[model samples]
Structure formats: C-alpha cells, structure tokens
Target: MDIKKIAVIAGDVIGPEVVSEGVKVMKKAAEIDGRISFEFTYFPWGCEFYLEQGKMMDEDGVCPA
Candidate 1:
C-alpha cells in the first residue's frame, strides 16, 4: 500500500500554530493505522511577507499549488 501525501499551506501569524496541531493529529492517525503516511508542508506567507515584498500574495500574483 502506498501512503498518501498531505500538503498544507499556512499563512503567517496563527497559521503556523493551527497547522502544527493539524499535523500532530495526522501523525497520530498514521501511527494508529500503522500503514498510512503523510507529508506535511507549511508555507509562511502573510502580512509580514507582504510588507517585505511590498504586496500581498495576491498582488505578487504567485499561484498557489
């Protein structure tokens, strides 16, 4: 059986905290199943990044995966 991949894109601020909890839950589930697996990815792009970049993610027009 092949394990599925899980991609999570979270903005800055509370986004990281929230996503961290979610990843913990998924990891627990994978352990219980003893087969399923997941790959979690968090992207920190929010107000701070926008301020530095001089634009919101939308303004940058970078497409999200």
Candidate 2:
C-alpha cells in the first residue's frame, strides 16, 4: 500500500469540528478500500493564534527545509 501525507491546519473552533468529520470520512473510506494510508500532520495556525501571537503561522506557514 502507498502512503499519503496530509497537512491539516484546523484554523478556528469551527474549523476543527469540520476537519474532524472530514478525517472520519477519509478513514472509513480507506478502511473499505484496504489500500493507501494517510499521515496527517496538524498545524496550529489560525485566527486565534494570530490574535495571541500576531501571526497566523510561523513565517506564513511554509515548512522549512
């Protein structure tokens, strides 16, 4: 089976709720297919973070090399 990487930024309170449902559906679909797998990396970047830190993400959410 192949592996897939998914970067998730659950922005605000409502964003998390929506992202959870999406993750659930994807997991169920994967189970039925019995194929590719997913690796999710959650980034805590959003309006709330901005309000506290004055930025939505670190360096505009670009992953460093």
Candidate 3:
C-alpha cells in the first residue's frame, strides 16, 4: 500500500462544506482502491483568518525547506 499526504485548507463560507465533501470522496476512492491511503493536514488559512490577521495564509504557507 502507498500513502499520500494531502494539505487541506477549508476556507471560510462555503469553502468548508465543499472541502468536506471532497475529502469524503477522496477517502472513498482510497478505500475502494485498497492500495492507497491518504493523510490530511489541515491549515487555518481561510477567509476568517484573513479577516482576523489580514492575510489569507501564513507567511510561510506550508513551505518545505
């Protein structure tokens, strides 16, 4: 089996709802395949965050370095 890492940012308003459904679909696909798994990491970079912090995402924004 293979493992895949996913970064999820469920933004404000409808973004959260939409992201939830998309995650469900991905999980279903992985289950049916029986060969791949997903690990999701959630971030707080959304409209609300922007309103509060004046930035949509972090200064680094999940960068790998």
Computed on alpha carbons, the lDDT of every model, listed in order, comes to 0.71, 0.83, 0.90
- Residue 38, model 3: Cα distance from true site in angstroms: 0.4
Tens digits of per-residue lDDT, candidate 3, 1-65, equal 99999999887665888999999999999999999999999998877898999988888895875
Clashing pairs in 1: none
Error of 1 at 14 (Å): 5.4
Specify the highest-TM-score model's number.
2
- Ordered by lDDT, highest first, the candidates read 3, 2, 1
Best model number under lDDT:
3
- How many steric overlaps does candidate 2 have? 0
Model 2 segments more than 4 A misplaced: none
What tens digits encode model 2's per-residue C-alpha lDDT throughout 5-60?
89888866668999988988888888888897788888888888889899778885
User: Whose TM-score is higher: candidate 1's or candidate 2's?
Assistant: 2
Sort by TM-score, best first: what order?
2, 3, 1
Worst 10 residues of 2 by lDDT: 56-65
TM-score, every prediction: 0.62, 0.82, 0.81
